[model samples]
Target: MSANPLLAADCQDGCFFVDGRFVPADTTRDVTEPATGQRLGRCAIAGAEAMRSAIAGASAAQAAWAATPPRERAAVLLRAAQALQSHFDEGALAIARETGGIVPKGQHEMREAVVICQIAAGLPLQAQGQVLPSTPGRLSLATRVPHGVVGVISPFNFPLILGIRAVAPALALGNAVVLKPDPRTPVSGGTIMAEAFARAGLPAGLLQVLPGDAEAGEALVTDPRVPMIAFTGSPAVGRRIGELAGRHLKKVSLELGGANNLVVLDDADPDAAASAIAFGAWFHQGQICMASNRVLVHEAIAGAIRERLVGKATHLPVGDGASGQVALGPMIDARQLQRFDQIVKDTVEQGARLEAGGTHEGLCYKPTVLSGVKPGMRAFDEEPFGPLVNLVTFRSDEEAVTLANQSQGGLAAAVIGRDVARALAIGRRLNAGMVHINDQTVNDECTNPFGGPGLGGNGSAVGGPADIDEYTRWQWVTVKDAPPAFPF
Candidate 1:
């Protein structure tokens, strides 16, 4: 109700961008400032009718937009990128206020979103079909076709990047999108996106932003017009979407839960390892799916690594992201705070040592580091999705690799050692889809493929050229110019 320190955009009307205009739904939902539990504003909550309209709009626009050539489609995305760049400060502030994410990280996510747009713009250069040798007088071609209307269900954490990451590529591949951003961060995650695309002269009804909760997501998933779904959220919800998509026989792409780790060998620089791992674990309050929640440090340098990590954690200024003094901000909401509390408590009760932190002041959680953690413990096995890391020691390189791969997680894994060759070798033994040699685990870029096997994702990487594969389906065609001579 009061003026927010980080407030940027005013959403007094509770409007959603649908059919090329800002329209209000009959019902509205409150968007809260997570750091203080303050009601920032009311946002439109879409009902079944609104969702059906959005789906129809996307379906109606798909054929024309698909026929509009990749160069023009890419031009629209490039224009959107520029427009979004001009609104960087406002959009970043919106993200900070909604998710308690630091403004700097918000800035990074927006800029990354811009880069993804630029990358998707280049998709036009990538030829989509291949001519295959066929029987006499018969010509065959295999082509990648757009999946028609794409349903994007994005998450609250890193909303801007996650939502736009899929949307840009889907649009580039000539498919219209229906985006449902988490209700908590609708403005940053969804609203600004529509503004940019509209400014870019994209066709009306090509992009729709509906901000709501589970009901809206269900509507999007069940809509038969949407032939594909791209989702970034919890594994539980992702599995449900997978099931629903399966029944409909629709394509699905998911960036789901992760149980990642950073392995530090005795030969590595302790300071470097500590710094990288701490940043990986605490940046964005460890809400990242790729956060290095499990730390496998050699027992020889365990004490030194522990001290450095602890020192770094305790010194970080924790407060509101808008304050500009805070290194890390608060959890998303009270439920997240409770989740971390129970995880830390259960971890400590199960024999892991709480080396530092494990305290909270209201919404702000102090960065936490746990030492002496072992297998079969929640902290070591599960993804806490909070500002915490469970530290465990290993004796040999063989054991370290074994422990890192034991989680059955396939998203990301890192090996930190001075010997580049050795780390590379050890990294090869890890089972994650993305491996970092002498670096942190929480690494991703628009130029790289980011997805995994097992529970991490649906094996469909969302960046680089992989986006083309995820957003399209293959079709084979055969044409005969004349009658073929049959070999009898």
Candidate 2:
């Protein structure tokens, strides 16, 4: 366990930042540590007035930020990355306690967050435009411009990293951002991020952190001044945000929930495949949107893969998040624990065999595996969003692909095989936006586009240089040798 207190003792009376200054809200919400169910700190829950102030502040700061050279804006992001690295120890411990991620995983995520900021900072140089062909003596150039004010709603699973992934690029692209962190694990992650930005010399109101529940989120997303929304969360909430953005004709980028699939071909090494799948299914207690919840194996290798996976699943240590030795940690809250229980019970009733796990104590649920899961089973169709893996067997590669594609979600998929050609071919047929061959789907790099297709996304891609492009708009400037013949 950490020698530091579960909650930041100084955080109880602290307020969020609006315009680079700490400001209190009309009300505050208590943030609880997931592991011990202890009240950690109080976060000011921004009311409508506070939300309006934040949006106004962002709108006011955007023009200047946009006018600032992209490289200069990117420099702030790089500095922020450096600041994050300098303070990683405290940040990692806070994230682990607040989000219930194991110490090692938390440290890794914090480091990745710093890397994301660095990559986002480099986006200015990466933002490229096209020189279109035009008539003689006419100079035509197209360049990307900022969207002004952006609102980002982040999830709890990766409180710091994913949030920074969106915020850094958005801010680096010259747009001011209003961040609504998940209420469950708010304090340390957002606080650390805000401090880093402040240290990087970000202008007042260029970045703001608002902590609250769904009401606060709705206030931020539905506000007309907030012209852009980048969200990462459940499908149900994604759809709701979509409807609101549609009504207002606002730009929105959504990375919603997923029921990712892992296909193990008969030709693959069973041990290697099982180990990879187990990690993908249980990492962060399978709370990740990219986690592989369905393992579809060729019938010929189903038995071998299942046995190996069962052994791996059973061996994972489940305990305190501060324990670096523990590979698994508790769910984010008791409500999630209950929901997971319901899904497991529903799947078992639908004829799926429980291979291992399914025991729950408070917010903790054991890493679970289920075999014989069919399309009709709840576990097969819905995203369990827990450390529960549904095993399905198929006779051929085509059938495995079909099974993987059966879900409404098309976030990500994985195929394990020795033959690169076979794996690539199978990966192509899968509906997910990203696929991995002979590796797990969790190996995401800052340079790779990480959004999904179908219900998993609203056709917007995050990460890579392309992401910086997404945060900005293009403007075509055409200069004629002589002003257009007439002022048509």
Candidate 3:
């Protein structure tokens, strides 16, 4: 039997990572594998009190962390990245076990996270602030400063990548973070991150991992000490967080849900389009926010595309990820699985044709394809975090764009066509934050500014230069040899 990969990290058995150490919580919760319902470990179920303490700890550590030299801060992030790289295999397995991602999905997320950490390492050293034109005797400048304490709330799907994308940059820019990973997948979502940073010799209290439920999340958002919030989750929760954070007057970066689209033009090859559709709509069981929830195909090729998609869905391996025998893993939990079934049934009732899938054994939902799905159907309107592909056929490019943009979400999108220039033009018309000309919707890079307009995000992006802007505030200063005469 293989050893539990989570245990190898040493922090997954239980307890909250507070003030530089793992402190046992008053209450604990069992961590189970979604695929097999096997107990992986236990984790602290931090309540409001514990979450506040963690925030306080971050507040106490903020100044010192900010005062550290840029090179030193950069070095720490680099070392943390290296530490994460050292445990790549262990981390991937833990992610797969905890979140029900297939082995490949786990590996991809692990890779992206590590790269993002490394990219963040250079953020502190980037040119910050600027000298402004001033009166002859005076000098004026604007400098970037940390936000003191940032609260990060991450979801179960793509936990490592989503959490680290914010946490690494916030810490890199000298801000402290109090992370609240989803309670369901605490080990991979937060504990693994804490271990990597600790191994890199990060100072005490700089990053506090508080694995908790909605209460803790709410507490983190409402707390006055945490001036910034970085959250990635469903739109409903994102709305609540936005409202609470707004009332608190906090600067929040909400990387919310997406009903992403994949457009297959008439000129696109059926085989290639089908392959991209399968990967986009079903990868990680379509748990990704960037997953292609809607497939908009030109009417001429819709039948051929549907046939290929059904063939792909029917043959996809579905089972427990730990077995290493499945292409599609289980849903994150039973609740999500139930939601998937209900969405498919409702779409069918709305006149969408279910050509394949629409079934599940345990948490492993079959990859589903629904043709003739139109606007107002639950599958077309709602963001699906499962393997259900809603195919909408359009006759013209204008119509394709209309169908794609009908969803409130304007996240990642894709345009598949052989005419590069025409495809680019169509991609530009789409409202998505990121567009793939010849590819699918599920693509991201550490350097890409990844956030969309509309219901998908708040327009505040996170990655590359965007991080520098999101994690810092501007401070203007003026210096003079003598005091300047005042108008008063």
The C-alpha local distance difference test score for the whole of candidate 3 amounts to 0.89
Model 3 clashing residue pairs (backbone): none
Writing each residue's lDDT as its tens digit, candidate 1 over 1-488 gives 22332223454248888888888678888888877778988788987778888999999999999899778988998998987787777778778888899999888888898899899888865989899998777789999889999999999899989999999999988899999988878887888788888888989898999987788888999999999999999888989999999999989998887678789989989988999999989999999988888889999999999999889987999999876889999999888889888999998999989988999998899999999899888888788999997898999989998888777575888999988998899888887889999899889888898988777878778899688888988999999877668999
Candidate that scores best on lDDT: 3
Residue 395 of candidate 1: its Cα lDDT? 94
| Error of model 3, residue 58, in angstroms | 0.8
Lowest lDDT 10-residue stretch of candidate 2: 1-10
- Whole-model lDDT per candidate: 0.87, 0.84, 0.89
Task: Tell me how far the alpha carbon of residue 268 in candidate 3 is from the true structure, in angstroms, after superposition.
Answer: 0.5
Scored by Cα lDDT, where does model 1 land? 0.87
Local accuracy of candidate 2 as per-residue lDDT tens digits, 270-366: 9899888888988999998888888898889989988987887778888888867688888998788888889999999999999999897777788
Which candidate, 1 or 3, has the higher TM-score?
3
* lDDT minimum window of 10 residues, candidate 3: 1-10
